[model samples]
Target: MVDKFPAEQQRIVKGLQDAVDRLNTIARGVAPIKVNKASEYFDLPEASPAAPGSGVRLYSGGGKFTVKTSANKTVTIPMADVANPANFTSPSTQTGDFASASAYTQLRADCARLHDTVRDLQNAMRAAGLMG
Candidate 1:
């Protein structure tokens, strides 16, 4: 003959699941923090010259007590041929925000909770001799 769990035991299990679900529901609107996006590959003047088929050209650009011997022209410029670097600049901003460790932390927490709950259920079932 099969033994059944008491009603109180079933109620306890159900209540635990309900509470976990409620916690998840309440955390739905957590917006990630906005990260300040810095540009990589900033334009550096060739300081000498640009050869054909080369992206680096020797050009001069500096002024106002900064570059005393600044060259008058920019060389090997990347933007010289390409139109609109802005398109490549924006999406990287998610507004292209990378996933921060904090986000991973939240995800890790969720996964840990999920794992623990699943383990709890598995152990409970095993104890009750209901697991295969």
Candidate 2:
């Protein structure tokens, strides 16, 4: 093929082939990049609000995770409060005993309330993408 081409073209082809060979050799000697797990777990600086009309920003500090929206709205969650069942309590203010005539009726009412609370929690978890 080099003989069929003009001298200048043949020289250019040779140079290109040499460049490709050199690249292949360099690629073989290069190690594949690896992820550094330690670097991935670095602590973030103090939380700051995101600019309005820009985008949301996530921040972590003081043992809490904060998300600030472009509208300057922010929500923070404590890291220690995550996935702790004891931290999830019903906001219901049903302080008094069940208003039932019989003990059996009161027990049933209490059980129903408990079931509803659990269901609400599960729904919340699902909405947050923490539960399947």
Candidate 3:
């Protein structure tokens, strides 16, 4: 085939064959380019606030993932806290003896316990960066 073509045409054919061979090699994963580093991954830009009834938009910025809903509500999740679950501590249990008191006293104690539980939950959420 080389002998059938002129010198210039033969060079062009060789170049084309070389290009095809390189593509085939890549397709077969013989010389694949690996993306092992975080920097090599594609980064998604922060999205604008979603329009009403348009659904939600999610993106990452300032070390947090922001999800903007069509209702104009934004929920920001800190990536650092999510990536490290071991850093989150369970809220301490609040104990009270509701059965040991009179009916009215017990009711008050129960309400106080419920309030304490709610406060503990809120504190836990704040500490875990789940709330402001």
Candidate 4:
């Protein structure tokens, strides 16, 4: 009782809707990634005058690279500057922690759904001879 072309068109529309839904679901599941700053170098309390060596000690803290000199002088080099001083130790590139397992699971599920939608979309396009 319905036109064959309209029926087929409806099927294609439904497939596209499904694909969009999957994409939306995947987007919701995605997580943002953050990178951590490199550890900094600190100067331990000046050893007694007669004490052993004292120069600079490496210390990790908020993402910043800093160094302390023997005279209790401290200097911090912005990450951007690390590269300016060619031949200098490159700043650390360690990244921050990751999302929770549950979040990851949800993301994975969404990705799977998106994958399925892509497949369906491809099939619809093929049936329409939109592809060679």
Q: What's the lDDT for all of these models?
A: 0.48, 0.63, 0.63, 0.54
RMSD of each: 36.4, 12.5, 10.9, 35.7
Distance (Å) between predicted and true CA of 42, model 1?
76
- Model 3 weakest 10-residue run by lDDT: 81-90
Q: lDDT by residue for model 2 over 48-127, one digit each (tens)?
A: 65555777677764556766778776656433223322322332434455453455455566677667767777776665
Error of 1 at 27 (Å): 62
Give per-residue CA lDDT, model 1, range 1-132, as digits (tens): 754766678888999999999988888867665445545544445243334353333334441111212333232212122222122211223323458665556556666666766776666555544464
Off by over 4 Å in 4: 1-97
lDDT of 2 at 33: 71
Query: Model 3, stretches more than 4 Å misplaced?
Result: 1-42, 80-132
What TM-score does each of the candidates earn?
0.27, 0.33, 0.29, 0.26
Candidate 4 accuracy as TM-score: 0.26
**Model 2 residue 52 distance off true place after TM-score fit, in angstroms:** 5.6
Any residue pairs clashing in model 4, and if so which?
none
Question: Candidate 1: global Cα-lDDT?
Answer: 0.48
Report the C-alpha displacement of residue 94, candidate 1, in angstroms.
6.8
Clashing pairs in 3: none
Candidate 3 lDDT over residue span 16-119, tens digit each: 99999999888898665666756555766865655457787777655567777787777676433222212213223324743444555645666666676677
Q: Model 2 off-target regions past 4 Å?
A: 1-39, 50-53, 78-113, 116-132
